[model samples]
Structures are given as structure tokens and as C-alpha cells.
Target chain A: MDSKKGMKRREFLKKAGVTAVAASTAFAAPNVHAKTKTYKWKMVTTWPPHFPVLGEGADDLAKWITEMSDGRLKVSVYGAGELVPAMQAFDAVSQGMVEMGHASSYYWAGKSPATQFFSAVPFGMNAQQLNSWIYQGGGQALWDELYAQFNLKPFLSGNTGVQMGGWFNKEIKSLDDIKGLKMRIPGLGGKVIAKAGGTVVLSAGGEVYTNLERGVIDATEWVGPYHDYKMGFYKVAKFYYYPGWHEAGSSTELFVNKSKFESLPADLKAIVESACARANISMLTHFESQNNKYLQKLVNEHHVKLKKFPDDVIEKFRTLSAEVIGEIVEKDPMSKKVYESYSAFKKDITQWAKLSEATFYDMNK
Target chain B: MDSKKGMKRREFLKKAGVTAVAASTAFAAPNVHAKTKTYKWKMVTTWPPHFPVLGEGADDLAKWITEMSDGRLKVSVYGAGELVPAMQAFDAVSQGMVEMGHASSYYWAGKSPATQFFSAVPFGMNAQQLNSWIYQGGGQALWDELYAQFNLKPFLSGNTGVQMGGWFNKEIKSLDDIKGLKMRIPGLGGKVIAKAGGTVVLSAGGEVYTNLERGVIDATEWVGPYHDYKMGFYKVAKFYYYPGWHEAGSSTELFVNKSKFESLPADLKAIVESACARANISMLTHFESQNNKYLQKLVNEHHVKLKKFPDDVIEKFRTLSAEVIGEIVEKDPMSKKVYESYSAFKKDITQWAKLSEATFYDMNK
Candidate 1:
């Protein structure tokens, strides 16, 4: 490729400056600090330290940056309750209490309702479609614009593909089965479940297993098979339902303090950005692999009954999902704007998906 | 986050080395040449220069590396037939004639039949499943083992997620409709089509458009909407099919000369790997957006008849796909080993995908 034609005029100037730097090395001493600067950063996450996949992703990102930058940058990751409370991750990053944060965007829905779109929506984009939308469609721009108000720069770090619906102590054969059911669910899903006459209870991860086991909560949706299996939910819940409509494809993000991110050198900035992308791919693959492995173990070894949410119940949830989404859009102007962009992207991408991914899977199955 | 607990012993050594280097700056004047060193490398790709998404991905990878390394690594890309023919990319990189090569693994099937599994297989894994397998399910380790035999290191750099079946001159109503049909298709897909009584012909990309128009080939399977729309296939082929079973999710890879890769400094090596990961995410997202956009254009403006292959026809192809795959395994021991790994991964991932992606789509649709 012709360097002149390939590079823009501004890039040409940058290249020329680099060439001059190479020439100047023959005479002058190097800037030692610039050449081997070490940056120590603190990253706060929502998951416990060393937790599988999700927490491991945070550690992987830190390790990758440290190794990739040749120790120029080191990130120390703190789990929930380590440096800050789990729910306070967003506040920590936004307030610059930490240099970085590893958390799902929806955790900050109270701060900005639009934040939910960046995480997942009920009956919305799946993992692949989410990646396509955020990276290629206009999702990232809108995300950046929305988060700028909070003084945070966000990057897509990891994804928990499509989460399972939930685990139930009894069969959910009809819409009537959902009524008055105390289920541990959260986000828009909880809202939809509540609208469907089910009692939605907010439960911590640690409390979820016992609540479901003791009939305190009749059902609970933790992640997919991998984490759920580790939590031993299958031992108590006989009916494991799937097609998590609430958090279809939950996207986790890396939140950087805008000013701190801007202060990094060009190389370090790229390192951070690329490391996020690597972790994004890595984490999802890890979840998919582990979930598949443990899912088999749950069914074959543990005798967990794999069940799909009945058609009528799914239909009810779908209808409620649409209504709940509409209500979310009407809450505020930012929600409306983000919802509009999101819905438009979802609609367009879904058309292609229906004709492509949906068809492929249907044919193969 | 406790650094003592988080950092491994090996990492501690690396960090200690950096700390010493930082301290030594007080005594040494400078290592000016090391600080300003630049690496100029050449990359050869299968697509023509500046070709949409595929070729652009190569250019993007090069640009990302250069910028990420702060001009420490500058890559010049040569498109098909510029430095070598399109099909010679693997050989060029393997022989160290080019430092890097951008191409799909399936093109090297003739060199090593096992290479086909790395690209796409008929009735095989979709892009998301492919990513999970390659990145998490030991696919990359096998890939490294396979490529190491040729002295090359491979990185999955791009993906065309769920390509369309093909463009047919006339409607395909049933299995009988495929009989004696001359089609421009290649790879294992071509073998499957031939087995189903269609006449498969090898044709170059530039020749495909004219060949289909002139009745030299009754149909052709180019990429999805964006490329097909640009190729003006709708002018001749009335039937545009859905769900490309042949190449379900085609993976494009970057091949680096193993010794050349080993020579890079720690940071530069990280820059290369991370830049490739960035390009992998970027290219797929680009394809998804452009394909979504152009698919609408093809249907609304160009009046392309979007059709799904009949269920019976799909079943026939599916049966033949299994047979073809078996024959492939029987060809060699390595092929058998790789096929075993791929099929096992496919089976495992498919279970999770069905419970998650499939169920979600079915409920919504």
C-alpha cells in the first residue's frame, strides 16, 4: 500500500514526527520516564474477587493489560465489598474513587434509566446482536453520549450470553402457574414478572440458593447453568426453565474515569481499549463453554429437569415485555431517546437475524 | 485488591524487572535505539486492495497495530495478486515470504484437509458458537498445533456471520430442483451440493456475476446481502436464499510467521495480538451493520425474492453434510482428530445455544 494514499494528512504528520524521533535517537538521550512509565490503576467490580467467568474476566483484563503493556500499566481489581459495595461500582467510577470499574450498565439504572439499554433489555438483542449493535450500529455513540454526563467512558468488557429463565420448584405449564409466584428476579424482567401478578423479590446471590431451597422464593433466576450449577440450585429446583427474557444477553462493561482515561498516552489508551475487546470475546466464550459443560452435568449427573417456559407463558411474558418497555421509554427524555435508538436498531437487526440466525437454528434443529 | 494475593510469582518477577529498569534510569544515559526502534512488516491478503470489510479488515488491523504501538510497528498490506496470488497467502506466510497473511483457513484445505474445520463446515456451528469453540473450547490450541506444522501462528481476525444460502436463477421448490444444476460453489459445500445431484463448478469471484447472468452457472453463493447487492446478482438471480448451511459462519484468520512473531518485544507482541482481536470484533460488526442495511436495500429497492430453502431440501442437505463430514474424517488421522474435537464442541455448544438463543428467537418470532 502507498503510505501517502493510505494515510490521512493528519496521520501523515504523525508518521513524520515518529520518523524524526527515530532520527533524533542517534544524538540525544531518551526520555527514560516516557519510555518505561509505570501506571498503577485500581479497578472495582460487582462480582466477588476470583468468581468464575464474570469475576475472572476482570482479572483477565487486568492481567492482559499488565502483560501487554510490559508492566507499564498494572491494574488491581477489587471485588464487591472489597473496595466498595457491589451496587456502588458505578458511583465509584463516576466519582473517580477508582480509576476503572467492571460492572453491568443496568446497575446504574437509577442514576440514568438509559443505562439499561447498554446492559440488556427484556426480549431484546442476544449476545451476537448486542455486539453488532453496540460496536457497529449507533449503540456505542449513544452510550458514550449518555455516560459523558456521568464523567465516565465505558467499554464493552464481557457478556453472559442468554441467561436461563429461572429455576422453579414446580412446573410452569401455563400463565396461571406464574401468578403470586415469589421469584427472585431483577431489572426489567422483575418488572414484567410483577406485572404478570408474580411477586418479585430482590435477593442477593448468596441468599438466592437458600431462598429457593426453603420456599422463601418459589423460583430464582441466577445466571445460566455454569453459575447456577455451582450455586447448587439444581438440587432444590426441579424445573430449570430457559430463554431468559429478562436479561436476554447481559453485557458487562469497563467504566473508566473520563479525565483519567484521557490522560493516558496514545499507546496505553489503545492497550486499554484492545484489552477490553479481548476480554469481551474471552468472557463470553468462557461462559458458553462452561455453561455447556455444566449444563450436561446438571441433566446427566444431577438429574436436573431441563424445561422450556411454556408457549402461553412465554407469550404472556412477551406481551408484558413490550408493555414494560413502553413504560420505560415514557419515564424520561433520555430513556425515550435511548429507547428509540435501541428499538430502531433492534428492529432492523432483528429482521436480518430472523432471516439469518433464526432460520439457521430452526433448520438445523 | 491485594497485589500480593492477585499477582502470581512469575508476574512478580516481571514487575520487579520493570522496577529495577525504572531505578537504573538514574545511572544510565539512555538506550536510545531500543526506545525508538521501528518494525516494518508486510501483510498479504486474499481480497483486492480496499475491498469492503474483508480487505478493509486487513488494513484496519495494520492501522491498529501501528497506532497502538505508537508507530513502532508499521504494516503494509498487499491485496490479492499484488505480492502473490490470493490462494498463495498461506504459503507466503508459512515460507516467511510475507511476515503476515490475511485469509480464511478453508483456502488451505488442499494443503492440509484438516484446515477446513477452522473455517466453516456444512450444517456446522454459527458465528457465536464458532467463537466459543475457537476462543474457549480448545479450538485455538488445536489450530495452533495444526498451523505450527507449517511454521505459522494463526489468529481469528474476522467473521462473516451466517451467510445467505445463495442466489438462484429460478426458485428451488424441492430436492429434485437441484438436479443437474450447475452452481458456482467451493469448499466442502461444493462437495455436498454435488452429492445432492447438482453440478458444482469452480469459478472466480469476478467471473461469478457474469457466469450466472449468462447461464454458464445456474446459481452462485457469494457472501451475504452487502457483497451480493454490490455484485448486482439480483439482476439475474430472482431467488435469494436464506441461512447459508454450507458456510454457516465463515472465519477469516491472520497467519503470522512463527519466528517473526517470536522476535517481537513483549509490548509489541501484545499490540499485535490485541490489534488482531480488535479487528476480529470490528470486522464482524461492520458486516452485520452493512448486511442489515443492504439487505433492506436488496429487498425494498432491488426487488430480490428472499426465500428460505424448503424443509425437505434442508433435510436432504443435512443428511448429505453428515456423510460428507464422515468421508472427510476418513481421509486422514489428523482430520479425524480435528473433526472429533469440532463435532464434540458443536454438540456441547448446540445444547446451550438451543436453550438460550433458539428458545429466545422462537418465543419472540
Candidate 2:
């Protein structure tokens, strides 16, 4: 390196004389290759634009990819409804309405029901453990296998870290208080809530605030403290709870149409994958970091009282969630296959986390 | 707390009747209360794990310390060789020589220098830019950061990334000539030599290869595949080379000393950071996922001609590498910052690396 050699590599280049733009530009720019190629792709998203974390994550992905490839591959990212209502992104991408999509699999439960296992399951894997299950533990390969049936190659693109329980219109005093509450819940948690005697509804972020404000829904969970505060849910409901069990560690994805994806040249394909990989890690920490600042603002600035869900309520949800998950296993073959593997891995990882992470966390200095 | 709602937060545990863990085994459970505990600390790193990415990264005041206690505490990690032999890790922890040590930092860049930057700096970035610059510019914080740092805290850890073209052995090739030149390489890309020009030497996979291989370091650069490979150069050299600059995105990290880390209250130290954010994109993937496969078959299944460097050969290395990079920077500060930032961070990171890491890897990535 620079430590030993007498002459610098940059100096050697100065003597030879090449330019900076050349350095930043893709090496293959103005390709002298006999054949020139360009790729045009459409990407649909689950989040709206410039919404900071989630939405911006998608926009940034598209922008960076275009720049990196030097216009060889062009991708236009359409926000939630710009392509399809946010929840519909999965099917649209799967059906090849677009070349790609940025979405959370939990939103597609109505389509396959089994897809929720990939995104999150109540009492499921945490982000790290989930990632391990997916990437290192045959989850991604199986996900690919499942999506292939739908003409899709799914990539884990984003994560919401562990989410917060929804904002509620009334105090969730006890397990018996949930009679006919309508909550915007999705994925496995929705089923668990339904089991716990709440009417589960599904809607996008842009709609949640209005619904909660209008009393159309008594409660709603939309990401974490940062976005929830932004949506002003605290103004409508003060009972914000901890431990989001529904979509814990929710992951977003760039679901590429298999046909279109299979056709790209090697370099461009690599570019797409790398870009998404960056997004995946970036999205998680982005939320974790930003949410801390925003949560303080929510309580200190907005006067939202943070409260833990009463134990009986949580206990009931846990019990019902377990039953709901079991029922899911009895109903879906894919779910069963996934759960079997998922739970097996979860057990192994839980043992480590309990011993390593749990112990350290419990005994304070 | 898991205790029932009727119980007070403190006595809540007894009321719940859940068994309490004995003090001797306390470092293994999750904390129930958050945000009000202080943690004293020590963290050991692999960078000597003493400095920079290997040490400093581990040592940077715990980001969570402020958030957890509303700003009452901080913990630090030490570098390798600070308390024990760079390689004698099992003994160090078992004996509690230090609370924790930074993770791998190249599984002990002492074990192998060529792979030291697996955490960072081939043609890497300065520290600040690494924290933000490289990641947004297509370098995710965790790419090889944690895996190369230790095995945990991927994003929290960082490598300088590809180092400068390392010191070398005799060289000079039409680029294709670096066949059968035995050199020590660490991490994954050490596996990619056919294109760059070299026959890699694989020993027990540690830092020792750098100097010991000096008699054999034909024209080595381990990091830039350029620099690190250079560091492992052949002894009594004839030709020197350039390029290996591709690892401009390498990283390094501070492995937190484990016990010190464990002693922190929940939230006071969230060791898991925002770094693990995932993306749907992939990169150098062809090399990572595909070419690696072919390169293997060629090297193993078919046994293509493996090579070493020849002097007329490195003449080209010294030539094209400069041409390739100078063309990259030309005169732009953005390019310069990109370059300067990487260089600067590398310099700062190295200060610590030199005392701890350099001593280890220089002797041992």
C-alpha cells in the first residue's frame, strides 16, 4: 500500500494522465464493444416518495442504479399508488406488470397467505435471526423457489427493524377489553388479532391516520415511532404500546419479474443485486437511528404517553397468536414447510440469543 | 416487565412468580426495564483488535450509551495484543483478561495480512466517508465489515476496505502473466485471481503470510487485491505493479470487548446497530456468486495454468493500475474527497492499526 512504495499510484497516473470523471464513471462507459446495450426497467414500491426512510430508500435505489450503470439500465420507481395501491405491489410485480417492485411480503398475504412467513410471523425471528434464516438457513433459496412459481425472484430489500404496537383510540386496559376493535393489522399478526377478538383491517400508511382519526379503526400500526409520530397518530390515540408482534422485523423486497431479470447481461445484473443489498442493510439502521430522535419528539414535543400493553392483553395475544399460527400450519402446505424450517431455526437461534443477548441484557451493572 | 399489571415495576417479578436467574448466571438473560441503567465498560478488539476499525470502531463511545441512560454512561473496546497474544483468543476470554475484544478484524489480521482489509481499505476511504460516503455511493456499511471485523456487529464494525497496492515480488505481465505467483490472500476475493494476475498462496489463513511470504511475495497486494496482494510480495523482487485499487470500498471495525459489552444495561448498549439494514440489490455479484464458481472449476476441475509474476509483467501492473486510477480522480474534490476521504480515513484508522493491527498483521491479515 501507500505505506511502503516510494512512488504513488496516483502519481504514476498523473505522469500517464487520465481524468477523474473517468474514475467515477462506469468503466464500461461508451463501450467500444461492437454491440451496445441498454436496459429499461420499472420498479413499483410499497412506500410513497420523499417520505424519508422507506420511500426514499426505494428512490435512492433507482437513482444510484441508473448512475452506476451509466444509463445502460434505466429504472423508474413508482410510488405506492403510482404503480398499484401499496398492498398490491407484490402481485403486480409477480404478474410482470413491472420489471420490479419494493414491497413487504406481509402485504401480500391475501394472495398467497403463506407469504407472511417470509416477511414476519408473530413470535417469529428477529431481524438478525430472520436474515440468518433467509440467507444462510435456506429461507432465501426457498423463497426464490416459491416466487419462481409466480415468475418472481424475490430479494430482501428493506426492513422496519422491530416495529411498535399500534396507536389506540382507547386504553387497552386488559385482555377482556378487546371486543370489537377494528385495527389495521396485516400478516400473521392480523390472524392473531382476529383470534384475540379484534376485527383486523388492512390499509396503507397514507390511509391509516385518517381512519384512526375518523374512528373508522380503533387502532393501527404503521412502522415505528418516527413515522407514527409523523403521521400524527399520537394526536388521535395515546395508547402507544411496545413490542410489535404482528410484523416484527418486517422486510421489504425488490421483486423482479423472472423473465426480465433472467435477460440482463452479467454486469448489469450484478449492479441490480448489489444496489438492493445495500438498500437492505441501509433501510434497517436508517430506521433504528432516525426513530430514536423522532420518538423523543413524539413524547416530549407531542405529549404522547408511552405505555406498555397490560400483561393479560399481551398474554391473550400470545396465546391466540400461537393458535392462529398453528391453524395456518394446518391450512397451508407452503406455510407448513416454511414454519417447520423456520421454527426449527428459530429454536436454535433463540437458544443463542437467550444465552448471549438475553443474559447480558438482564443483569445490569 | 413480564409481571402482571397489578404489581409494581420492581416487585413485579416476585409477584409474577417466574424463577429468577442466579447471580453467577446473570450475564445471560434479557433486561426487562430499559432507559434507566448505567453501564461501566471495557471492550477488546481484534484490530490490535486494538485500534481503528479493529479497535477504535469497537471503542467509539457506545452510541446507545446516551440513548439508554439519557446520557449517563459509556463503554470502550481495546485492541488485540493489548492484553494477550493476537491469536490466543479462547484463553483470553476464558480467563476474563478483558471484558470483550473486537471480533475478527481479519480473524486476527495477524493470521493473514492479505485478507486484513476484508473488513477494509484496498483503495479504501477515510473514516468519515466510510461512515457515510462509501455506503451511499454503493458501499453498504456491512459489506465485509462485520464478517471481516469479527463474526458479529457487521455494520457497527467496518474495514478500511481495499488497502493500497501492497509491496510486491518480481512482476511484469501483459496482465495475464500473474499466474502461479504464490501469495497469501484472506477473505473471499482472495479466491479471485485469474483476472487480476496471480497464483494465490493459501496457508492456515492468517496474518503471518505477509512478512514470512516476503521471500516469496512476487508482486503482492492483499487488499486492493491491489495493496494487500502487494504486501505479500515475493522476496528479492524484480518488478513492482499497480491497480488492485478495486477494493476502494473495503472496511474495518472495533470489536467490542464481550464482557464489557454484556455488562451494559439493555438499551444503554444496543450492540446490534443500524448497519444490518438489508437491500434487494446485489454487487460484484458475478464475481461473488458466478465467476467464483467458474474460477473454481477452472482452478480445480480443469486445472487451468496457475501462475506467478514475472518482472516485465509488473511493468504493466505499475502502468495500468495508475492509468486506471488517475483517470478515476483527475482533479475533482468529489473525486478527490472520494479519494482523499478514503485515504484520510485510512490514515486515521491506521494510526491505531499500526500500533496494534500493523504489528500483528505486519507480523501476522
Candidate 2, B-chain TM? 0.42
Predicted complexes: DockQ each: 0.35, 0.02
lDDT computed for candidate 1:
0.84
Q: Chain B vs. true chain B: TM-score for each candidate?
A: 0.90, 0.42
Once fitted onto the true fold, the runs of candidate 1 whose alpha carbons sit more than 4 angstroms away are A1-33, B1-36
Q: Distance from true position, residue A39, model 1, in Å?
A: 1.5
Pairs clashing within candidate 1? none
TM-scores of the first chain across all predictions?
A: 0.90, 0.87
lDDT digits (tens) for residues A49-153 of candidate 2 = 666688888887787566545454668988878768777777787787778888777677777767788888876665655666776567888788778888998
Q: Which ten residues in a row have the lowest lDDT in candidate 1 chain B?
A: B1-10
Candidate 2 CAPRI assessment class: incorrect
Q: Write the per-residue lDDT of candidate 2 for residues B67-107, one digit (tens) a residue.
A: 22222243454455666664665335434554444454445
Give RMSD to native, each candidate: 8.3, 26.8
lDDT agreement of model 2 with the native: 0.53
lDDT of 1 by residue, A191-216 (tens): 99999999999987778888887899
